[model samples]
Every structure is written in structure tokens, then in C-alpha cells.
Target: MKRFFLLVLCIFATSCTGGGSCAGKKEVAALPDTFIWNLYSDPKSIDPGLVQENSGSDVGVQLFEGLTEYHPETNEPVPALATSSDVSSDGLLYTFHLRQDAKWSNGDPVTAHDFEYSWKRALDPKTGSYYASYFYIIKGGQEFNEGKNTDGNSVMVKALDDVTLQVTLKHPAHYFPQMIAYPAYRPVHRKTVETFGDKWTHPEHIVSNGPYKLVSWEVQKEMVAEKNPYYWDAQNVRINRIRFLLIEERETALKKHLEGSAHYTDDIPTLKIPTLKSNPHYHDAIQLATYYYSINTKKKPFDDVRVRQALAMSIEREKITNVLQQGYPTRNLVPPGIPGYTTAKGLSFNPEKARQLLSEAGFQDPKTLKVTLSYNTNENHKLIAEMVQNMWKENLGVEAELYNQEWKSHLKNVEEGNYEVGRFTWIGDYVDPLTFLEITTTASTQNYSKWSNPVYDDLVLVQSGKERDPKKRFELLQQAEEMMLEQAPLIPLYHYGRPLLLDPRVKGFYGNLQDMHPVKFAWFEEEK
Candidate 1:
């Protein structure tokens, strides 16, 4: 799953001369053969192994090709680095045949050995990858990541030859192919990483196997990439270059889009939704994502289950969703519409019960239970935090201080357990109930709540993967979600919708559940 707050930036201009066409405004001319996107923020990390958020994955997908890639229209896994693959009858062994034509941007041949090294490096504990658990399905992956296994060779991933990669799984995973399409499974140029160390991802030093290669990155300002001629299918890659403008304000981003500076942008101001609902360029789709408040369970007051439950029960989710004019209000962690799975409901708004629960937890006055609510910088997040802050004060008589930080710093604060309650969002990496459920497991680095239970670990980490029967496996997952909800380590707010603005000239971008638009498949329409 992807972590990080969703938002965008733009500077507002006062006058539009010709109706709504922004006439007389000196429009930023669209560059021929280039696709300019308003990438919400500067990606925290472009390194696939360390990226845990959409900002990073969005750019990473353009620069690195995994064994499989998501289909433009369907999001189904399709061959990329690997031309084809075979699975053993037992479903535990996977053999991927690498594409002989594939080569890194630096002209080095892309081989199966790169995949083997990349997977092992991701699983290395020193790497501190939040997504390392994703490899646990591979045999010996968990042991190696947990430091229980010292030998890297013990992991089941291996390069049988220059073109063949073999992987042995601990159990059958029906979605293994789809899982490999995620950024965490993308291969890195082993030599580049070893030589440059932390600077390997710099624009000049990076060597990639995807359709595009980084040419420049101006930190919070912008990043530019040019098409990679060494890429296996480079001829079919229509866009010659991509400019990702790091815009942080929705109003400013909208203004830029209106001024013809951007071809595609997913950030829209909440207040402007009604006016833009019927605009030809406006697009909205339900995404496989959840926005919630993660409680620091190890911290005081939140350490009590009663306190956590009370906090959850006091949220007026319906009001928040209604105000934002976005998102489907939800109490369940897993969003609906996943095949073969049903969502389990959790705590609902009950001000009286919340007050009683606070009293029962030894905080009778409620006013004495003061806490801080932290969130990343964004207009919507700020508004939501204020709304929740008021709800807690009015319902439970609890006072909360609202703290905001930039996207990168906010993620660090949450990971370091620096807040009593923090705003968090998770966009599914792949379409599956487990993608959402597994993040809360005790050993999960994404578990910012710092809450754990043996039953949850057993159900999600151990039993769910091993259960071969689809129906039985889903039941175990549902049960695990219900158990976690009962403890209230997090308050599920809503399943958000991805609101986007696209120029009519943009083509090949399709709406999908995961909200992923691989730039390799997108192109600008020829001018008539």
C-alpha cells in the first residue's frame, strides 16, 4: 500500500478576460512531445525499495520496469521485464523468463541477477524498507528480514541463468503476479546503487530499465525525465519527455492547469468541486484507498483501549464527507468492491457512549485528556482535522491541538511515534483485501499505530496466506479486520475518490481502482 498525504499546489491569478477561457493571459505553451503533470509533491524517495508512498511510486513507475506491469486499461499484470513466466503445479515455485532485449538506460543488459539482488537487498533489515514485508510471501523472506536468518542466500529468489529468475514462495499466492507489478518488486541497477550509495537515484547517476529515465530533479520545484532509448519497447513509448511539477496548493495547480501549463493533474480544491463537476476536463473515480487517523497506542491515554475506542466513536464521518463533497464515509479499513471479499463495519458516531467510555477509562472530566492531532500540510487535511478536533471537544469534552507538517516530515514524525494521533492515508498497491489488512500486522513497518495482537498476527500474517480455499481465506481476513476494529487503534474515516483534471489532448490515461496511471502508456494527441 502507498503511504503519504494526497494534495496539490497552485498560485491563483485574479483575472480571466475571455469568458472562462483565460483569454489575454499569457498561457504557458505546452511543450511538443512532452507530458506535463502536476505531481502533488516532490517524491520522498524515487528508490523503489524505499518508496512507501504514491508520490514516489508515481515517478518510480516511469523509471523502473518490474517483471510485470499494470495494464493501462485493466490494471491486470502484464509482462514487462519478463517475456513470460511459469508456475509449478504446487503453486509455490515461479519461473520468470527475462526479455533478452531489455537493457538499462546505461546500456547494461538487464538480467535476472538484478532481480535477485534487488529482492534480497529490499529484504535486508538495514535497508529499512517499509515494504520489506511484501517479500515475506517468498520462502525465507521473513526470517531474513527479521534478522533470524543471517545468510542472504537462504532467501528463495535466485537467478537460474542470465535470463531465468526463479522464486519459491512459502505458500500459494494467487495474486503473486499482480504483487510483482508493485514498485517494491521493480529491479534496480545493482552496480549503480553500489557505486553511488545514497546518491544513486540522482538524475545524472541513475540507470533505469523502464520507458523513461531521469534527466533532472529540482527538489520541491520540478523533475524532468526523457524517454529511454535502451528500453525494450521504447519505440512504442509515445511521450518523449515528462515534466512533473511539484505543486503543493490545489488552487495554484488548478490555475496552472487552466493556464495550459499542465496536461493532467489529480489535485482539485474542495470548494471548487461543485463548479467543476460538469467541466469537460473534470474527472472523478472511486479509488481503492482509505483515509484515517492512526493512534499512537504506545503513548499515554491512547494506551487505554477505552480511550482509543472513545476517540473513534466520537468522529462524525458523515459530516466530514458531506462537507468535503468527496469520499465514501466508511468505518471499515478495507474499501468495498474488492472481488471475493466483504467489508466489516467498526465503531460509529455515538457521543454519549464516547463520554461514558472516557469516564470508564478513568478520565471522568474528559477536559483533562488533552492530546495533539498531527497531519501533513494540505487544505483538506487541515479542514478535516479542525472538524474532528471540534467533534472531540463537543462530544467527549476532550481538547486536541492540531499540528501540521510538510509531507516528508509528517511521515517521519508518524514513523518515529512523535504524535498522539496522526492523519494517514493508504492507497492499495494491488487490488486485494490483504493489501489493506496486512499493514496492521505486528511486525509491519507501516503499522504507525504501534498496536499489536497475537491473534491478528496469526490470522493475517500466518494463516491467511496459507489458506488455499478462497472463501476460507477471505473469512479469516474479515475476522482479523473485525478483531482489529474492536481495539480501535485507528479511526477509519472514508474511502476517498480521486478527483482529476485532464486536458482533452491527453490520451491513454484510464481510470482504475488503484488510481495508477503509468506515464509510459500516456501520450499527447496530435494537434488537428
Candidate 2:
């Protein structure tokens, strides 16, 4: 029966391709060991320490290996560069045993020292790593990054030997192994970075320790990564090469997939969702991510809690999500289905209360209040921005100017606090509420809104990490999220339902909660 079904599927696929021409058969027979991915946008930076965007990490994962990596099927963190690890009785100290077989793309040995140097570089103040706070779990890491301590030696990550690394955390964290899988913790070739400086990431200079090594990069067009011969698990890597295409338009990406030019694409036009739902290649699943608008709290008018709340309460999130046919409307930043954590309900659409709040915030004549709404250049984002603009105008008589910028520029403007309110999305780095909650803290570089509350910070940054009791820790996190929602520094819009197109020939690709599909395990099935 399964064979019969596959036969039918093949027939259907052929019929859809150029009116069942022999050309389609030839194309299928000639499928290469390369995985062509529509990355959708040009990655801002592929440097492990510097990558904060999803697109960059998608590419970074291909070219780097950390102590751990996400399991292809489960999204669970498993040992990668490290063969195994031992935890001390206190659970504060972790000792990782490096895999001796691990080697960089250039055939250099990957050692514990590489991990130590890469981690320290991330924490170095001069690196300007936006994700520096993620390493705060390590003792003295926060102090070093914040410039409170001048000694890098004080930070408790130490290479005990060429093959063993010792890390002492300020607090006990059971999920430390999982957290290390994040791109920020990946090791870079120390010598290559030192010699080339910022140019170390160029294909000619880069020495990576993952399944793939970047061979060519044409800015704004495509990046190609060939298999790394020296990678520790090279024997298991199926995909020999990966072509990351920078196709910004969703329509173009879908067209490329349909035309057999690309095997995988991260986006499809929202309007096409209804028709594409019937296609076998179409995949739509709720990811552990949230889309929201980051209000620059440091800016005037937005600084007022009432004003921020008014803006948050005014948006009809359901209408936007319904119209788009993607994502579940959400007021809470963290999506549901996390183990042992209950999502906190946030302020819903109440335009009457929003108007009252606006008046209370001293904007009696709402026309006097004008703000700019910024988003990256994408049709979906523009549509959402337009909906939001109209909602603000109609609900509270506030005028919102839509400011669109390309991906890189949008990231820069948000990072530098150059925009009033910016569209943003946060996908969980690990399977934890801390991944989303930590972004609201003052120390977080992801906190584009620049919203800070001491009480909220302590709960998430300090208390939650130290609490060994899962129940108590979750409660602390929930409280923090609730408090953050009341302040409304950012307006939560929806939990992401990522719609992707994957060619039938592609195998070993699973849609995990993180939406992260490591290409090392993916391969094209041989044509029958």
C-alpha cells in the first residue's frame, strides 16, 4: 500500500511539473547531494558570538559546532564537540570531555582551549556581543562582560587540559547543556579570528568545525557551504553541500521550490496558504516563537506605562492573525506547551480602555500623538504594519507612520534605539521560558525596547536560575512575564505558525518546536 501511494505521489509530482514532460524525469534523476535552502534574507552576521537573528543562526549552525547540538528529530541538546560531560554534586560545576576526533575545516584540532577562547571572546566587552548576557550563568561571566571585573581569569570557564573544559556556574542550572547548543556558545577558530580580525568569517579565512565549511559567499545573493572533511562526525553527514539563497520575496522563494531550483524554503505567501495546504510539500506548524512590536520605552510618550498599555490594548491581534492565516493570536510573549509552565494571560483588545488610558496619559486629543512603526521589508510584515497603523488610528485617533527597512538595517535601527516601535520576533534558543523572559531584562541585548524593571530583572536573571524547584522557578518566571505585560514595553501579537515548503525528495528533515533543521542529517533520496 505504501509503495502504491509513493507511486501515485511520484505520478502526481511529475504531472505538476511542466505538463508531465520527460524533462521532469531527467531533473529528478539528476538530483544532487546538495540541499538548496531559501534563507529568505541575507544573514546579518554568521559569526557565532555576533549572531542574534534567526537567519544568521540558521547559517551559523551549518559552519560551527559547540559542546552540544540540537538533535535532528527531537531538538534536544546532545553532545557534539564534547563526547560526554560530568556534573559535580552541587550541580554548579560542569566538566566536559572534548572529542579528540574533532577537527576544524582546515584540519586543525578542535580542543577545550578553543571553547574557552570562543566563550571568553563572546563575553569580552570589545566584542559588543548582543548575546553576552546568555553566558551570565557562568560565575564572573556577567561581571567580565559588564566591565565590573577586569580579569578574564575570574570567569570560571577554564580549559583544565587540551581535551577537558571546566565551567563553574553562579547558580545550578540543569539546562546548561541545552543552553550551550545555542549559536552564541559555538567555538570559532581562535587563530583564524586573530589573524583575519573581522574578516575571519569570509569563506577564504574561516575555519569551521561543523559538518559544513563555507566555500563561497556572494553577498545579497547566495552562500555555499561544502562538506567539511575533518568534521568529527563527517561519516554521518549525508548532505554534501548546502546552498543558502538570499531570496527576500516569499513569492519568489515558493516559485523557486516549485520549479525544482530549491529544496527547502522557510516562507510562503500568506495568501497562498489556503491553496498550498493541500500540497504534500507544505508544512505549517506552531513554533516556539513569538512575534511582537518592541516599543522604545526610552523615547517620549512611550515612556509612560499608560501610553504603552494603551497602544498594546488597542491592537486586534486576532483580526491580524485571522487575515494572515498564520500564527495564533497571543498577548503573552512565551508560547504555550512548555513543560511545567503556565502561560500568563496578558491585556487583550479593549479599545475603550485604550482610549481612556490614552486620555489619562495626557493625550486627550489623540491626533496630537504621532508615532512611527518600523518593520523589515517583507510583504507580510508590511501587511501587519498596515493593519496596526489602521487600528491605532481608528481606535485611539493616533497616527502611526510605517517605516520599512531591509533586514540588516532594521536590526541596526532596533539595536541602536533609532525607531519608535519595531516589529520583532523571538524564537526560543532553548526549550525554556528563560529564553523568552530573559530578553526583557535590562542586561539583554535582545531587549530592543530598552525596558528595565529591577524587580523583573532579579526574578528572571537571578532568582529563576538559582531555583532548583521546577515549580517555584516556573512561578517566578510567570510572575515576571505578568509584570512585564502590565508595563507593556512590548506588545505581543502572536505565537508563530511557521509555514515552510520542503521538496519530497528531501529526507531526515523534521519540524521541531524550535523550527531548527540541521542539514547534516538531511539528504536527497536516490531516484528509483
Candidate 3:
């Protein structure tokens, strides 16, 4: 689950020069001796509290660790830094036993104080953490984040001793274990953070407790992670180091792959996909995210649900998925197989319904109804935007302006309220539907659309607290989803399915719902 932007660059000039008996092919760079993986965008920050997208979060997984980790094969929570934990009978308090051998990259012993400090830092209003919603379950978390409390002393997070940690929550959450697997819940060294201040994210300043340590960082070039010799599980880790190359140029990255310059390349261009399918090296993987466009509810015109519904109904989702996405688009907001995801039904393309709704909203002259739709600067995003632009024009008789920006700028615009309609996608941080649906709630910092409804918010809040009866909880969540789809808060576009280039020599590699590229246990084999 990488958050990358689409960057368009001037193609390198290539020519075919033929001698009397042979043709010359384009020359490309040779592969390095190190294991290199190409990324489309550089992370804005490796700090878990500041990261809002998957790409940044995944990289954080290498440099940080929480009390728990998710087993990708089972999608179940397991111990990472914490050795064991127990819950109280009331289910509001949890006590954890830290790993005695755990140590930070700087050789500092890991302790419950580290966890306590990290949690409080995230909840502190001054920290400006966008992912603090995950900690709302802890008692006083909401109050602390809202500035109603002076400091973390009032919060439920506490260090009982050097190895024992205690936590108190507002209610019992069955999915609580799963939530901590994400980086936002990871422990940070208080000393390192305070020492570096604003420059904490730089490679030289960061201290990690995970399986790897930051060896070096060259912005827009490549970042290196070497094996952490002090890691508690260092004996189990095989790879000495992993090289992450920032390859913003898609064609160049592909050319490098052809020249054996990188071990992995993600998101192959649509034009080259067909020819690569028959190649032995080709591998396809499904991404657990849904791509869609959102209209800013705080803004005019979009302030009307009728306009939102009309806009949603106008687009022919089938054509977009079939033609633009090559039949990989998913219409529903929550991807199937996740909890609370029901195959009940969804809104379909109805030009007449869209036009009538638009007319009802007093936009009969489709020529006058114009809105800007924002998209990232990737080749696939451009194609999808062009298709949606055509659909809105033909169906609703409205001219929609296509606005494209770099991926980072596009995300910033959405978060900062610069775009009227923003293109976005969210891979689930966990397997629950709430992970996907709850972000749009009125109070959620991730809710870029400004969609707020008391009824919708109440149901989600209630479900989050209820720990018994999965069926009943899902029923309430289903109702909330129906409400969201009916109002058309955002037009659900399609589910993601990207082809991965899995090396034949590599094994134990699997695609995750979060699009996590887990290289820890993956290894190459020599055939006998």
C-alpha cells in the first residue's frame, strides 16, 4: 500500500540505428549488486504520527515497531515488541509485558516508558498528529487531543515499571489488537525525538527498534536500510540490507528493469501489460484499496446532496472499469471480504436520473454546471479522469474541468481544502470495514469531504464500543453504509488490482490488503 503520485516527464529520446547486418538497441543502466526496489514517490516523513497514507506507513514499518504486529498470512494480530498481554474482566484495561531483550537501534533498552511517551505524544494537541483517531479508545485521549486536558498525566496510558505497561480505555474493542499493528501505534524514542526536534525524520537523527536500521538517505535518489544487528530477532533476519530506490520516472524504471537494474517494479504501464503477461517473470497481485473522487461538502454546489447524488449517478462506472481500467474497477466503497461488507446493492449509471436530479437542483442548462475534478499525475489516473470527464459531459450535459497535480501536491490539496473534487484511494489499515468507512465521519481528520451526519456518526461510535455479537454490530454498520451510499458522499469508482513482478528466485512473498511488501522472511532459492 504505497501512496505514490503520478509524475509525467519528457520521454528519453530512443532511436533504432541499423548497421549492414544488425540493429542497435537502446542502452540502459546496469543493475547494482544490492537488492533494489523502485518507488514512485519519496515519503514526506517517516514519522508515524505525520504519515496519512500507506506508502509512508509501509516504510515506517521497517524503522518502527509497536507492541503487536499482523501476520500477513492469517491477517491476525501477533506479538512484535510486546511478549504478552492480558485484558481485565471489565475489558477496559489492558496490561502488556514488554520483550526483555528488545533494544533500540541506538542500543537503548526498550521499556514501557517508551510506549507511554509515544502514545501521549500522539494524543498531545501540540503534536498535530492526523492519525490520533486510533487512540480515541483510550480514556482521556479525546479530551487530551481536544486540549481540554493539560498533559498526558490525565490519559490512561502509563508505565507500571520498566517492562510492564498498563492502559485504560473508554470501552472494549475486539479489533483493538488489529489497530496497533499499524505504525501510528508504534513506540518512538522520546530522547531522539526531543533531540532532533524538527529534523527528527532525517536518516541521521532517527533511531529504530525494528528488524532494520536506516543506513543512508539520498532524497529523490535512493534510501538504504541495513540489518539491525541489535534487533532481538536478528538471528532470524537473513537479508544484510535492502535498497529502496526512488524511481519517479516510470519509463526509466521499466527500462532499468529490462536491463536487470532492479529486483521489483510496481504498477506496470497499461500499454505494456498485455505483452508481459506471457513472460515467465510476470506476476499479478490484487490491491485492497478503492479509488474514487470526493466532492468537498464544505464548498458550494457540493454542499447540496442532490448535486452529489446527481454527480455520482451520471458516471458510467462499467465503462470506466472496463475501458479505462480494463475491467478492474469496483463500484462499492468497502472492498469485498472485509467485515461489514455486504453485497446488498449500489447506485448504477442512469443518465436520465442524473439529468432529472440536476434539473431538480436547478442546473437545467448543463453547459452552466461546471466543477473541477482533481486527479494525480499518473498515466492510469489521467486515463480514469479523462473517462469520467467524458461521462459527466455526455450524461449530465455538464462540462467538468480536469485538474491534475503531482501525487504529493494532490494529497496536500485534499487535506488542506484546496481542491473542490479530489481523486483518492484508501487501502485498509486493517481487515475491518470500519477502517474504510469510519474515516469519512464528521470528526475524523481524514474526512476531507466535510461530510457530517449525527445519525451516521452515532451508529459508528456505538459500533466501535460494542464488543459482543458480531452480527448485530455488522447490522448497524450496514445501515451506516447505506446512508453514506444513498447520500453519495463520494462516488465509489473501482477496486484496485495491479500486476506485480515476482522474481522466480524469491519465495514467501505475498500481497497484503495494506499492500505491504514484507521482505523479512522472503528469500531466494537455488534449484537442486
Candidate 4:
């Protein structure tokens, strides 16, 4: 494992020399003027209604505004784009009062109609929006999404006036306020999206109502966003400009940070952890992200619960954590530090118990069991997958093959059910443990495992429908977590610690356990 970590660092250092074109530049202490961070892929869209993942959402947070926002430290819901909000006693109807000062990047007032159009567009079957299900609580939203109902008569979302909007829900949800804080639920200017079509995010077509506006975007190179002078809070935006540079190689990012081309970077090689911890400028901590392997329950081998349990038991989670992960080990899908996570009954690593279960289930010979474990090319994912492959071959007497795919294609495979066992991860989109643990529910689109448990589904459904009592609702969610652990449809790997290298001169740029990056308060001073 130590050798593997060293190998990664060595590859990174090697790539900085002859492989990449920037190899010739001299290194320095900090970036010159511009603030840059590293991203593996360019943002898919600046339009909030269309963003489905963190890559898009992270950028969307900078480019769009939602009716509500989470208080940076407490995760409490507060008004952002909306001035005030109210919920009916039944909890099915929500009304939001828009802030009069809200305006689009192009200087048009952002009204209740913008929210109405955005919600309708997302719920319309023609949009093919994956995040549309988030609005299912809204009246007729599910029917509209399924084409059972038309847009005109749907009562899920509507504008009562220029600044007041109403949202009717099929059922009440306690987390609905938190849900609104996510970019996928943010409001968008319909005319802008319609006018730009597919090129809506292609720089020239970009419009933002947040603190920053898209000023320039160079594919696979750099994306530059300048402060929106027209934003309601423009005077309070501490950073004048932000540049997101797409640097896939950790070594290249490190080199750029060292050379003063980037102020902060995401991937800090594990070997550098000790030194990074020692430095005052470097802030390294376990981010809320959890890494796990999803077994395609729809496929062979994995369809057998014994095989899944055997595979889960063969690998040593502690070994992987101590050896490969710079962060902490995760016992289940629900990450620690979240509101509802309990470690008392988490997944136990017992090889003997696992083997007994496997043998009882009739898996004995290595020849009888054949499976494929797939992962993306991230050094961490590959390293862990290799460790699991070796563990399975040694302990279970099973023949296992490893498959590596590019990140995008790998995500496609997992989403399309193209593999028997595949790697997957989730960082909380909000503070709730339900966001991570509930992704496996039969109704969840992100449920790549295709795992279905009627009891588990009922627990979640009932809670989302009637459990208004926060304490009782959480108890029901705990029951759902227990059921998932019992099924073992997914292997709970380690929770990730996000390690970032930052310049000493930069301030107010940091992230919390939820991976929330708020650059609004960040500012730069000349390096001494």
C-alpha cells in the first residue's frame, strides 16, 4: 500500500516534466492575481435547472440563486433569492415571497414566473430531467413526469403574482426546505435557456443571478467567472474573479500550486499529507464524501446474496483504510457527522462469519464464482479495487477480474447497469443522512444496485408522507438503514477526507463536511 501511494506521487512528479506542455514553467509560491481551483471535468451547464451532480452544482452555486440557502456554518435554511416563505398546516402547500432586488445577470428582474417556468420545465417529460423526481412531493409532479398529466393543469407549481409563488405537494416532507437549497432546484430564466438551446452554458449564452457571472470558458483548459456587478449582493462579493482550471493530474495541480498558478487544489497526494498537515496554509480533513461499490443486483453472481456477502467479507476495510485511505473508514453508506448516523450497529468485518455465510449459501470453489469489479481511473479507486480483487482471490477462492473505465464512461456504465459490480460514491447534497442512505431505495433513480425491499420502501414512503415529528422520522430512517445493512447490496468502503493545498495569502476559501464551497467570503492578499 505504501508502495502504491509512492507510485502515485512518482507518476504525478513524472507527468510534470515531459508529459504535459506546462512542464517547462518555473514553480512559485502563489497564483498571480487570479484565484483558481482544480476540477476533473468542465461544468456541464451553468443553468441550475439542468445540473444533476456536484460538478455542475458547485459551479451553479456560484452562477445561480435559489429561493432559500443554507447558513454556511449551521446548515440552517435561510432566505436567499426569496425574502420570506410559508408552509400550510397540512405541509402540502408552500408559498415563497421573492426578494425585490433579485435580478438576472442581463439585468432582468428574476420573478416568481422564473421559478414557475423552471419547475415546469424540469417536471415536463420532454425535458428528460433526472432531478425531476426531487419535485415529486409537489402536486401532479410525478404524473407530469410520467406523461400521465399535462403541464397546463398541473398544480405542483404556479406563480400567484409577479413576486409570490405557490407550490402544492402530494405529500409533506420535512427536508423540503433543505432540498430547495440545492442547485438542481434553483430558479432559471426560461427565455435564456430557450434562446441558447444546447449552447446555454457555452460562455456567450451564460446568464447568472448569483454573485458571479461566466466571463470565459476554455474547454479542458480554464473556466473564468468574474463578479456580477449587477448582482443584488455584488458589493459584498469579496472575490473579484474566480478561475476553475481543469487539471486532471494531481502532480500538475501541485506543480501549478507550487508555481503560483493556482491558489487552491483538491487532490493532495497521500504521501504529502503529513507535510500538508504541518503547514499552516494547508487544511486537510475528511470531507463528507463516501466511497462504495454497488453490486448490480440485476446481474448474475451478485444476484446471489451469499456472493455479495462473501465479496463484502473477503476484503479488510480497516486494512484499506489504514493503507490506502488518508481519511476514515466507513461502516455503511450513511457517512458519519451527518445528522442521523449511528455507529453502534454498523457493518462488522468478520471474515469467519462471512465465510460461513458464503459456504452455507453454497459458494466453495474458486472456479464456481467469477465476477468483475469496475472502477474509474482515480488512483484511490484503482488502488482499493486492486486490494479487493487480491483479497477475494486469496480468501474466497474466487476468480475476479478488474475493469477500469474513464470517470464519465464509468458513471454511464453504473447508471445504465452495464456492470456486475461497480464503484460509486456520494457526497451529501444537503446535511441529511437520508440523502446518502436513501439513494438505495427502490424509487431512487440513483439506486444503481437495483435493490428493492418492500419493507424498506414502505418505511421511507411512510416517513416522507406522514412522519412530521423529526425524532420519529429519523427513527424510521434508522430502520431503513438497518435493512440496507442486512441486505449488503453494496460494500461500504471508507469515507473520504478532502485534502486541499492552499496558499497562505488566501482567506475565506474553505469547505465543510458537506463539501460546500463558499467562495463568496473569500479574498486574496499579496503573498509576503
Would you list the C-alpha lDDT of every candidate in the order shown?
Answer: 0.87, 0.86, 0.74, 0.72
Where does candidate 4 clash, by residue pair? 28-259, 30-260, 31-260, 286-497, 366-397
lDDT of 3 by residue, 1-528 (tens): 221111221212121121121011432132222456777668777887777665577678777778877554444566777777788777777888787999999899989999899999988888888788778879999889988888779999899999999898887766777788788988888898999997887888888888888878888888888778888888866666767777777877776665555656776777777776665456666666888888899888888888888889888777776764343555577878765557335577788998888888888898888899999888888888888888888888889899988888898888888888888887777777787778778878778898899888888776646646677777777778778888887888888776655444444455455666545555544223
Model 4 misplaced regions, further than 4 Å: 1-33, 340-346, 526-528
Comparison by lDDT, 2 against 3, better one: 2
Best by lDDT: 1
TM-score of every candidate: 0.94, 0.94, 0.90, 0.89
Please provide, for model 4 over 244-329, each residue's C-alpha lDDT reduced to its tens digit, 9 standing for 90 to 100: 88776777777777666776777776665665565544665557678888899988767888778877877778788787537677
- Write down the lDDT that model 1 would get: 0.87
Give residue 315's lDDT in candidate 1 (0 to 100): 91
Q: Global lDDT for candidate 4? A: 0.72
Spell out the clash pairs found in candidate 3.
1-515, 3-55, 6-377, 6-378, 330-494, 330-495
Q: What is the lDDT of residue 291 in candidate 4?
A: 84
Ranking by TM-score: 1, 2, 3, 4
Model 2 weakest lDDT span, ten residues long? 1-10
Model 4 per-residue lDDT at 234: 84
Off by over 4 Å in 1: 1-31, 526-528
